[model samples]
Target: MFAADAASRALGIRLLASGPGSATAAVVVTETMLNGQGSTHGGHVFLLADTAFAVACNAAFSPTVAAAASITFLAPTGLGDELVAEAVERVRQGRSGICDVTVRCGDRVVAEFRGNSREVHPRAQRPE
Candidate 1:
């Protein structure tokens, strides 16, 4: 997944670290990510946080996918800003999981995200 995350790669996002139930990702805002308002796009910010949440949830679980997610933007960032997203697993039970991700620029939080994941059986992907 990391080798071929085309969307994240296109946005210059890098997975800095990941482990069971935790992950961190980073991205440097560029001109292409700016919106017409001249600030970073909210979608890009959500993507970064969502990526981190995905990694953390899938770290120990096999082929987990997000069932739902929501984000609240706290601040806006400009081009050249360095953003970091960190995800932590809040709960995982019986194929259901919850994760929280925080997006920040330095010490200031830029956004908060929560993701709900449901684990899929590998067998489900096989054609009958």
Candidate 2:
């Protein structure tokens, strides 16, 4: 069981108090995450969302891996504008699960992400 705070800390994400997923974790956009235009880079946003997904999935299953993932950039995020990413479990089947994630800043959604993950036994915990 991964507490929300621990999950956020593990992923280097911060929890925001407002937004679509306000009560959830959001990645703080920094200068190092900017692109040539000084806007948040798409890869950086994706990584943030991906990290959230990793924590969400693995928190329950111990070990999980992303099987498929995609993100659509809707708007640009500037430096210092906290980029919030949220992951909600959509469906689960056996050892596989699907999550719908969204990244936003204030009222503007920066990106939408969907991730498919597979739960696997940890290498050290593998059965003989």
Candidate 3:
């Protein structure tokens, strides 16, 4: 999707999955994205996971909206480190869904996130 691409380019993200529900996406860590200690910023990880969640939820149902999200940082990542974010749909309730996403570098788990999204009715589908 163009939104995904634009978000990626503007935020310096990379697509690892070809489609929405795929599993993972590669994220390149740059110095600009790192903190003072040379580790990736928490916001970067959150954005990566959030983007993946958006794609996953939207692919299943269009116009999906994020209801809630929680992220946990387990480890640190640095510049030049290629991170992989994997998102899995955990549950679906009518027009809403929950997803679990994990970010890793090789065998190290860097972060994890849980997100919820809701599908909004299209203009044509709205009740008149």
Candidate 4:
């Protein structure tokens, strides 16, 4: 899944590691990623977290997509900051699951993301 993620790749997102129900990704803040105040834009942070969430949810080979997601920005980051996002599956029941992603620059937490995922492929659905 991460291998085919064009959007994430375009923003210089690199998949660091992944395993069953978990993933880690990183991106460097670039000049183009900054906002008016010279801080990294929230969208970029969200994308980093979203990418990690996508990888974690899709680790099982079943196509999954985010049904809903939200993020909270705790700190500001700027150009040259290497942001790392770690995603972990919090819950999975049937075809629905929840994942949490934490974006950090070094030891400082920059953002927290929560994603609600739903398996889109029929093969992932439980038989009645």
lDDT of 1: 0.93
Native-to-model Cα distance after best TM-score fit, residue 4 in candidate 1, in Å: 2.9
Better of 2 and 4 by lDDT: 4
- lDDT per residue (tens digit) for residues 1-128 in model 1: 56667888887899999999999999999998999999999999999998999889888878899999999999999999999999999999999999999999999999999999999888755566
Write down the TM-score of every candidate.
Answer: 0.94, 0.78, 0.86, 0.94
Q: Report the candidate with higher TM-score, 3 versus 4.
A: 4
Candidate 3 residue 66 C-alpha distance from true site, Å? 0.9
lDDT winner between candidates 1 and 2? 1
lDDT of 4: 0.96
RMSD of each: 1.8, 4.9, 3.0, 4.0
Colliding residue pairs in candidate 1: none
Each model's lDDT comes to: 0.93, 0.73, 0.80, 0.96
Model 4 poorest 10 in a row by lDDT: 119-128
Query: Which 10 consecutive residues of model 3 have the lowest summed lDDT?
Result: 15-24
lDDT over C-alpha atoms for residue 106 of model 4: 100
Give candidate 2 regions above 4 Å deviation: 1-12, 15-23, 124-128
lDDT string, candidate 3, 23-127, tens digits: 567778987899888899999889888877877777656777789999999999898998888888888878888899989989999999999888888768556
